[model samples]
Target: MVLQMSSNQANPNTYMGSVVASNDVVIQVNDLHKCYQSYPKPIHRLWQSFMPKRRFYQEFWALKGIDLTVHKGETVGIVGKNGSGKSTLLQVIAGILQPTKGSFTTKGRISALLELGAGFNPEFTGMENARLNASIMGLTREEFHDKLPDIVEFCGLGDFLHRPVKTYSSGMYVRLAFAVAINMNPDILIVDEALAVGDVRFQRQCFRRIEQLKEQGVSILFVTHSTESVIKYCDRAIMLDDGELKLTGSPKEVVQAYLELMFGSEKDTDALVKVDVENYKVEFDPSIDNCPKQASYNSGEHRWGDSRAKICYYEIFQNGAASNGLMQRGDQLVIRMWSLFEQDVDNLIYGITVKTNDGNAIYGTNSRALEVETPAQRAGDLVVVEFRLKLNLLAGDYFISLGVAQDHDVKDNIAIDRRYDLIHVHIRETLDAFGIADLEGDLSITLED
Candidate 1:
């Protein structure tokens, strides 16, 4: 496809600039833009070709004024809603698409696992396709043969590698593609939502390979809808919104902004009446401190919602006694939060979420999902909520998030009070476990002679 730029090169509205060069920089983008022309009908295209002076098509800019830089060994994540130019940007960087305006520079051999089956020939066998892809990535015949065993082992396609790629499943396609890309020893890797097609085990394996590549000083640009993956793997992240580069910061911060953009409403925070916490009266066990000063409370919690309700106090308990953030893996735990309402609200929902220290959500449930009835609350009403469950999770640092909202419907909910990462809990190890949760499998042995 041909790219066209606006006539005015020095327009004051444009972010016209160039990126500074550095030896450690693997990739640098400066004021990038990509535009596509749309014709109303096939006749319009013919007419446009004949009448060069007349405009018969409309222009749509898929990307505009994007600036980015990646240093060696850094993993940067791109996050956005659909049609946010994420794939377009990656395509431009991968040399599959040219920019309409602006410049970018890359220093090293690049390998990309972009759209599913992008570079594969369907008629070719999986093994043949692997060899072709490796050659395209600049590997010699001898070099590819040397790495063929590693590629085959990593993909685990086994006998399927000899079959035509057209017969491969989506998961198989991803496996073969990722295997070739990772084994190519690229200086820069660009992954665009390809791993989501793999099974859980393969995804874990791919991430491990990515970690190894990171240690070898490979710069990577990754794009996925999985915020948890971004937070867990990326050192930094950038958010794209409606073809514009919106925000760039830590992975957690960028994911938070992306989620807010997706779910946030324009409700006025000041319109909700504020509750006076000092005058709110509720009876609690005298031995436990429900205030924010409790040991389980996370001082750096992030909170946002309308001011109609407020979570005033919270506490954690184990075995009927208030406990700090530490607990055994199998212990039963209780989380309590007190919320004061300053206005009438109906169909209230109370929710809690358990997340890893890096913000990967482990478990979350709300009153609605549990079939618990919640009546309307009026001004000056105090509501206390308790969530109790066995800590079946593996030993790790975890955080608890709390929220209170008015369920308008299944799709729409009004957040009254929401606090993220409000409490920190550490699960102490007892028995050996491998994954996030212990399934408690029963063991049986069979003796054979």
Candidate 2:
């Protein structure tokens, strides 16, 4: 069932209502549904028009019973698989497409980046297109002229602004269009995967500008398939499945739900169990498996995947004993994790990554990289994995992320379980280091004389 509860009210797991009440609400959508009539041939459309009352075209609902609300300064990320009405919803909100049923409302001016060169004419120069696009977004002639300098500088188009848009590449076109849309001083910004066309640096610049707009109280509706960006920038996220709102909540939870839906098999019925390392019977060598701390069962500390397997506990050992959050530079460390299998997993890959506290990835390696062979695991089986990593890092706090997935690095490989920020390690500086890692530079500055 579709829940239409207000954002200001208690957001229960599921409920039903007609309106989302909020004093600061900038966008409200209630029981929104969009349908498109598809005809098999051109003659069918004409015949339907002549019949008047008879139906000839098939009805397709791209959006089904969508209820959402956004307030001032809120950035909502929309995600789903392809053909799930992401683009249709954005088009409806941008006034480019009208709903066949239900309704929606938007307060304040909205500038959208839905189509590439949407409001620009190919015959017109970049300068002319900028003026035309700004004017279409409700900017007056005086306002357009006043913002022209800023737009040109933001686009980094220099003298190319005088050239006709038909001669420009896709990146150049998006740059100009994005610059114009943002410099219009809009109260709401709607992006629909248009930023994916630009290069990395341009995308970064766009996101930075979006952050600035967010700070200035501009409501944003963003649609993208990138989960990392959704987690990093969105305050709230909603997932759509087959034209239905499947989940809506914090970014991490929503993204996790989406990932599980895409990769997970049938749900398992076994309850989670934590076994103490010292007490549990050893199936393997006790010397290699024993660690100081007890096994932890905190599933809340990380995001998980399908229930085929799970990481029950993890710890880091320095030298021979378990280390408690402290490690020195160049210390030999062993990272170990215990996995509990709920379903048969033929092949598995163990992966580890080290990142800065701010989530910048410093180093990453997988079992595949080391050519390590893992035995096939069966249901009810427990496996222990230990990785030897050099502590050749600069003095700073870092996080470790772990994951177990299918035995491949391609897109088809499914993650059996994954955890972010699963372990935190702090390193005390013993020598001068400037970057995230100490490259171990060799000083051989001998005198030429």
Candidate 3:
């Protein structure tokens, strides 16, 4: 029962299709609730005996009223802060835990690589553990026979494969476990942060394998704190807050929502280590912006073109993706618009702006630069504009605001879209190893003594 639905029509809000169907649902979770019992404090229990407050126990709802459907061959990601119940949901899906209120139906074989050493035996040798774990995963000898070579090669643990698992390092064990899971040929692959355990090269190798599976249309339900990876890898994502699914959309939207939560408390920190609060600012990259020569507008009937549409909300993401303040520099970010038009006018104009914390304009672009003219627009039309470009910014936070105009005059100038406050990114030396960034350049330097 793989959720398999092909798109016959494009969703108005997204470039991707909304092909959801009941028959196509490979995985379904309805009213899923997982709760944990919490005993009252000893003093509270004593006081309850004397004067109870109706109930004496407490319940922690790990998941509340969760309803999600995953179609076959779709790569979906789960994102949230710690304690947001992402791990709990994945556990129920993998049959590791039972939901108190509801259950999920999943089709086909599911191979889960969650916590490291979850299914391994420390007493057994690596080779023995592999076979033992494979059997636990419901893999037959014939299947393991076919996949053993791949597992060995992926792990690069030739000599150690037969050594006692108890003697292996944590890294070695993780490599072996991940290799076996990938070779299982699962219909559903649940990968937690298992890839993070191995070295950088190994991590990249695993990502490449996952990427290939994505090309082959394997259904993946991945959970990670890394928003950048989610945005880059997952076609869509859902954001969770306090055991509830809060938002579902493109990765950029979900990650931004998570960061705003982090910043709320982090704003008061006196630390300057990760982000220099005083130096933080956000804006569009001017290098990638094209000042328009003219503008377009939307009419009242929500026509394809005209002016007078006002934006209600929007978001910008780099590399066309993001994580909780973990985006990289020189990433290509996209801008999305969700607008509502009130009245029709002769002209309509829109622009995107990126600025620094000190109020310096890093970049700005609008329809005016396209050298186009539009007819008068009527009222009641809706508009959604999309812009994408490579962002060549130093790692830091910045803010963006949308610009609105009519007849070459500011009608509602500098309208507040969504704010990207202190979008955080880690500038690593390894970024030079991949992507198309100039990065000023990378080379192995040697001292000529």
Best by TM-score: 1
Per-residue lDDT tens digits for candidate 3, residues 1-449, read 01111211222111112223454566778778998866667776666677765666688999998988888788888887789999889877877788888657776667777776777777777888778766766677998888888988998998899888888877887788778777776767888777666788888888899998777766789888776678678877888889999988776666656644532221212321221223213232221122121121111111111223445444556565533334556666676654544444445556666654433456777776765554555444445577675656664445455545553332333221222322222333443355323356556989999
lDDT of the structure predicted as candidate 2 = 0.76
TM-score, candidate 2, is 0.80
Model 1, CA-based lDDT? 0.83
| Candidate 1 structure quality by residue, lDDT tens digits, 1-449 | 01111112122111234433676876788889999999999999999999999999999999999989899899999999999999999888877788999987666777888888888889999999988877676678999999999999999999999999999999999999889888888888899999988999999999999999999998899999999999999999999988899999999999878866665545665555554445544554322235567888888887767757778788788978899989887788898888877677788899999998878898999999999999999876787899998888888889999999878654367777788899988988666566678788678899999
Worst 10 residues of 1 by lDDT: 1-10
| lDDT-sorted candidate list, best first | 1, 2, 3
lDDT of the candidates, in the order given: 0.83, 0.76, 0.62
* lDDT, residue 213, candidate 2: 96
How far is each candidate from the true structure, as Cα RMSD in Å? Answer: 6.1, 7.1, 16.3
Clashing pairs in 1: none
By TM-score: ranked, best first = 1, 2, 3
Candidate 2 vs candidate 3: the lDDT winner is: 2
Which residue segments of model 2 deviate by more than 4 Å?
Answer: 1-23, 266-299, 328-332, 340-344, 354-363, 369-375, 378-382, 390-399, 407-411, 424-449
As for candidate 2, its clashing pairs are none
Better of 1 and 2 by TM-score: 1
